[model samples]
Target: MIEELAHDPQSGAPLSSVKNYPGPEVGEGLADVQTQAYRTGVRTPEQHPLVEWSGTREGTLTNGELVSAQRGLLGYFRRTHRNVRDDPDPSMDSTAALALKRLKAEAPRALDSFVWYALAERLAAKGYWAAWMLDHVIARCPHPTQRVDGEVVGRCGSRLKFRPGVGKLEGVCAKCPHEHGAVDEALVEYIGDIYRASFDEEMEARLL
Candidate 1:
């Protein structure tokens, strides 16, 4: 689904207009984002904007932002929304709420995807290595166990630390100390068939 926002003649506030659209085509998406750039302006020619999100839900506003990208949401989630009646103003997240809606239409839990929240702490920390995530929520190493003269046994299922902000996506297994080089490149091979990259430059900019 693609949403095009039209400015109101009376109020001049951008209105979210949804229209039926097919797969993630670069040109079509760029046009739509150009209209609703106020929601989340992720204009990077190298990638599609994933941070600009919106969904259809009752009482749901049209402009929504991803927690991974939204600075206010990152702070809100840092507090875990405690003692708060409503989400921060201008940070309304109807966009993320409809994540499952889009997924069900496509695969229905059949795919393993990156959980941006899983790295909330890391992302909020604004470290040198951030935003490079693609594995499942609980991403871990699946390398076979290796023995250095009978020192280790079983699968090396340790958490992998990702550094995608360093101009490339790299994962380092904690337990095995194994390095998974260029996981981003590995995923890029399946872009048209098994994967589509929805990128938002706004998220990256916030970190900077």
Candidate 2:
């Protein structure tokens, strides 16, 4: 599901103009992300932007590069949705499954970069539910990071003093603000959008 927003003739606000058309192609990386999300039960048919973009859920909005790339991601996932849902591949190697396990265990400490957030917001503005869902998953998962003492920490901050194996995260929850809630549901959608943009950029650069 690809949604393009243009100025409405009557209202002058961005209205659903291209609701009928099938938007654009989301790419393979995004497709993989969508598949992973589906297997994990994070994404739902309702949340997916396959049928129409307007009906999907809302999360952060991302525009420009991220937005364009997200469209490619949507297209790719749409194809995968059809393939996996229609025919289950028994021999499939679930790499995303392992990645999810790590993500759940590690827990990310930070949100995406400022630029990434901006892109996500733009996608939301355009009514891309997958954007919100994907971002949520990554945001909720335990972010991976290392400590000065050589041990791995889920939440790292200035207040916490991590020792090699003894001291864990003793940081103030309020001091380091990014502790939003779990959004594991959107992991696949978000990754799909990111991967599509990367692949497309590489392809375009090579052609240039």
Best by lDDT: 1
| Global fold similarity of model 2 (TM-score) | 0.18
**For residues 103-181, what per-residue lDDT tens digits would candidate 1 score against the true structure?**
3233322222222332322333433222323211344443435667773333343556776557765766655443543
Output the lDDT of residue 53, model 1: 26
TM-score of each: 0.26, 0.18
Deviation of model 2 at 128, angstroms: 6.8
Whole-model Cα lDDT of every candidate shown, in order:
0.33, 0.31
The positional error of residue 174 in candidate 2, measured at the CA in angstroms, is: 5.1
The local distance difference test score of model 2 is: 0.31
Tens digit of per-residue lDDT, candidate 2, span 174-200: 233365222222333544543454334
| Leading candidate by TM-score | 1
